[model samples]
Each structure stands twice: as C-alpha cells, then as structure tokens.
Target: MSYEFERESLENADDRIVAGRAADGDTVAFAVLVRRYTPMMRAYARRILSGSADVDDVLQDAFITAWEQLAQLQDPGQTKSWLMRITSRKAIDRVRVSRSYTDLTEMELPAPERIAPPRQAEANAGVAALNEALLALPDAQRECWVLREFGGYTYEEIAEQLDVSVSTVRGLLARARKDIIVRMEDWR
Candidate 1:
C-alpha cells in the first residue's frame, strides 16, 4: 500500500489495531495513537498537577515513556487506560520533586479585570475558588479525586495506580469531596 493510503487507513482504524501497529514499530500508527489520546491525557495531567507549569513537560515525558515501552503493553485494546496511568505517574513524580523546593517569595498579583457579564464573573470566581480548594487538598486525596473524577478511573483502577486499597481510595475521595464542599460553601 502507498504511504498515504496506510496513513488514512490507520487514522480510521480501531485503537487496538493502531496500538498493535505502533507496537510493531509503525511510527505513523504511533503518531495516530498520540493524536487520538493527547487531549485527554493533557487534561488528566493538568488536573493531577494542579497549577504546576510543568504539565506539558509531564505529558511529554509520559509519551516518551509510552513510546519506549509500547512493546510491553499486554493488551493493545487497553492503550488509553495505559496512557492515562503513565500520565498520572509522571504528574505525581513532578509533584514529588516540586515539593522539595520552597519558594518563599510572593508572586506579583495580576491586576483585576472585569469579566464581560456579572454572571460570567461569578462563574469564573467559583471556578477559581474550586481550583484553590483543590490545591489546598492533601496530595493523596487530590490524586484520588482527580483520577476518579476527572480521569474517569474506577476506584479499583485508582487503587492500582496509587498502590492503595480500594477502601483507602474511597476514603480519600470522600475526604476530598467534603473539604471541597466546605471550601466552596461561600460561593453557593
């Protein structure tokens, strides 16, 4: 088949097939997988890393790791979950490394700018407040919450990713929810 034909075919192929091709060393197929999953992976990274500026770096690291380890993927059909798990781990690693460095200086605050409508401003404030609440959460609880709520991982899946028991995942999620609710009460 011609290169264009192969590329088009891969574009329309099922993830399992594309992933298998990627595992077999087809760079185009791998590119297709990257294109298919990058958005979700980025969003997942952003949620886990909170306001960290290294979210893109974390995602790039995950993709590089994925490329290096694709051959070890036990099931091609599970590629999406596998990629997400890798992203979660990379984000966690970044958080761990960042925790060691203390920045004592306060950042210059941005000047307040009015959002278009009052309702829009109120909505933005609520979102900003929620982000602050999420940032305030303990790292474990925040990871569980982001993986479950944003990444759409099951409790069992989160437990596996975090190397914790299912009950522990449940407890973390519950605590996170309660804390976020308390923090956001003023906005309601």
Candidate 2:
C-alpha cells in the first residue's frame, strides 16, 4: 500500500497495530504514532525540563531515537510508556549536559491556557505559584517530583532514571511536595 493510504488507515488503529507496523519499518505508521503522541510527549519533556527552552530539541531527539529503536520494543502494546521513557531520558540527558537546572535561579513557566472568564482567575494564580515553587526546589527534588507526578513514572522507574534508590526517590518526592505546599499556602 502507498504510504499515504497506509497512514490514513492507521489513523484510528490501536496503538499496538500502529506500533507493530512502525517496527516493521513502516514510516507512515511511525508518522501516525508521532502525530498521536507528540503533544503529550512535548508536555512530558517540558515538565521534566522545567519549562526549558530546549523542549523542541529534546522532542526532536526523542523522535529520532524512538524511530531508530522502535524495532527493539518488546511489546508494541506498551508503546506509549516506551515513548515517554525515551522522552524522559532525552530530557534528563539534556539537563545533565547543560547542568542548567542547577543554575535555574528563575524559570519562566510555560504559559497557561487562557480561560474564558475571570471567574477562573484564581486558578491561574495557583498554577503560577506552583510553577514558581517547583522552580525553587532543589534539582533532585524537582526531578523526582516531575517524573512521578508529571511523567506518571513508578517510584522504581524514577529511581532507575535518576540513578537513586527507590527510598531516595520517595524522600525527594516528599520533600519536594512539602516545599511546594509551603510555597503555595498563600494560594490556598
């Protein structure tokens, strides 16, 4: 089948089918996966990188890596988490190379979606405050929090990514949560 026809057909296919095709070197199937997951993967990378300016770069690198390694994926059904893991690694790798997080004295929050009415004004304030507090956290604490909360990674997964013990991941998350809560008390 032509790539265009295959792409169209796969648009509504289950992730497993799309992933299976992609693994078999079907570029159209891979593009479908890309279109399906890019927004979420972008958001995951952005949160992990703490609104870094390199979000697009990270995403590009991640897609390249995913396309290259899709065949090695053991279970096509698990494609989403696999992509997320790649994105998280790509994001963390960027952080490590730049060491930018250690020096993030202030970070511009990724803009919030505009609400239609002023009634939700306080919601924006809460988001702003949370972003500020997250920026203020120690690098380890922030990584743990973002990976678990934003990435939806398991504690063991976070530990493996961060190269810390699960206990350490738990501790970091706790401290990060406490610090955020303290910082956001005014929003409450």
- Which candidate comes out best when scored by TM-score? 1
Per-residue lDDT of 1-188 in model 1, one digit per residue for the tens? 99999999999999889999999999999999989999988877766665457878998999999999999999998999899889988987787778621111221224357656876767666767877887788888887887787668899988988899999999999999999999999987
Q: Against the true structure, candidate 1 has what lDDT?
A: 0.82
TM-score of each: 0.79, 0.77
Instruction: Show the colliding residue pairs in model 2.
Output: none
Candidate 1 residue 108 C-alpha distance from true site, Å: 21
The models' CA-based lDDT, in order, is 0.82, 0.84
> In model 1, what is the error at residue 10, expressed in angstroms?
1.3
What is the Å distance of residue 33 in model 2 from its true position?
Answer: 1.2
Q: Give candidate 2 misplaced runs (Cα > 4 Å).
A: 102-132, 182-188
The weakest ten consecutive residues by lDDT in model 2 span: 102-111
Model 1 per-residue lDDT at 66:
95
lDDT of 2 by residue, 1-188 (tens): 77677678899999999999999998888999999999999887777676778999999999999999999999999999899888988999998788666222233445557655663666566776777797799889988887887678999999988888999998999999999889988877
- lDDT score, residue 100, model 2? 61
